[model samples]
Target: MRYVVGITMDKRGRDAVSLALTLAQSTLTSHPVELDLVHVIRGVPPEQAVSKPEREFQKLCLEEAQQWMAKTHDLIPKTIHSTTSVHFSDSMATGLIDKATERPCDLIVVGAASHGPLRRFTVGSVANALLHSSPVSVALAPSGYLPPSRLTRLTCALGMRPGAEVALNVATQSSVLHDVPLRLISLIAFDARSGAAETTDAASDHAKKLLVRASQSVDNATEVMVDVAHGRSIESAIDTLTWDEGEIVLIGSNRLARRQSIFLGTTANKMLRSLPVPMVVVPRFPAPESTADDDISI
Candidate 1:
């Protein structure tokens, strides 16, 4: 698998690169993996030449980007493979998307916006834009976060929707590839009409059934578990669950304007707003030709 990591001359950007390396090493142990470290100079046109002052500014930006890229490269272990490149564009988000598409990377990894008590897990403008526009999967690493020692668990936020099955399949594959356990979670917000207890029961029942089918789709050696969280709001439901340091969440992307673009649904968006750990937003896979007979909803 190939991963494109967005780099800037900052600590947060370096954190993203570190997380990307961790993922590549953990998930692609048997297969060859590549990481492309990319830095984009925003507000600069790729085709146009700049004046003397602007040229000097561009030179400084490139020099800074190169230094950061070099420092990041030194941190990577000798076993892992990586390359660095710089790009010029009017928008950083669009430039990242274009670069990833050109490489045809499987995933795009980026850092959180900035470091602050309130913005620790908050997505930055560039990352938020990529989440909506990128064609490939996008992974967000929290600010000041170091890669976990091991990726032992994959927690998937399962939904009863058309694209959810795709997310499950991706999660299952990741679990099998990394030799980890998979947890299929469904968060049900309390509805005034449905009642809390009833909603929780129904969601739990559906989740168990979905887990059974999802497990059968993956390797028999892969272990799958299911859980249902209920609360007044999505954030509350997610907060109720306990998370491991090595666990990562996978949620299906919901696209509206583009057929296969990466867009978060209401619930997914809320979860990202106060994300507890690193999260990967999996793009909806194309529908299969034949439908199988199964009772699972997600």
Candidate 2:
């Protein structure tokens, strides 16, 4: 599988690159994996139009991108073959999507956006746009996150819906490939409009059945565990659960949306707001057919 790490001349971007490298090394042991480090240079304003200052600014951006590439190259292990590229475009999100489409990468890694007074790692503009439009899966690295020494577990946020099986399959495959344990988790939010006790009981029962069926499909080498979180909201429910380091959460796209479209449901979006660890958004199976030109250049 080919993985592209979107980098910028900043700390968050470097963290994203490092996390991507860690994932590549851990999961691609059996297959050939190629890592591409990319930096997108937003096009200077046309209003500036050929002015000396505009020209100098463009040159400075290119120089900084190159320097970042060099620093990334030094951080990579010699065993992992990699390449670095720069894209010049008007939109950072579009440029990255184009680059991923051109490489046909299976996954794209980026850093969570830091904003607001607290500077919490929220889903930034680029990631938010990609979540809906990207042709492939996207992974978000939290602010100041360092790659774990190893991938200890993959937790699937099973929704007990039609498309949720896609996420289960991904989590199962990752566990088998990386030889890590697999966990199936379902969250049941307490709805005030409904009978809370009955709803919770039904949801818990459904989650247990889903996990049983899911566990049967996995290989013997992979260990499977199950849990269900229940509370007033998705966030509150998730907070009640215990999480360890070296764990990643996998979420499936919406089932009713267009095929292969990355549709983040309400639960998935809520989970992203306070994701404790890295999160991997899994698209639907049988990726949508693309007639659009793939040879996009920045």
Best by TM-score: 1
Q: RMSD of candidate 1 to the true fold?
A: 4.2
Report the lDDT tens digits of candidate 2 across residue range 204-273.
7877887776677674777898887888899999889887678888888877556766777788899887
Which consecutive 10 residues in model 1 have the weakest lDDT in total?
289-298
Q: Which ten residues in a row have the lowest lDDT in candidate 2?
A: 289-298
All candidates' TM-scores? 0.90, 0.88
Q: What's the lDDT of the predicted structure labeled candidate 1?
A: 0.76
Over the stretch 1-298, how does candidate 1's per-residue lDDT look in tens digits?
6788888778768778867876777765565568888888986742354587777777787788788778878877778788888888878888888887784467788988875343257777898898887777888887777777888788999876666777887788778777788999998887677677876777778798888887897758678999888888888888899988777888888845255568877778899876667889876652221113321111
How many times do residue backbones clash in model 1? Answer: 0
Give candidate 2 misplaced runs (Cα > 4 Å): 44-55, 116-120, 191-193, 286-298
Backbone clashes counted, model 2? 0
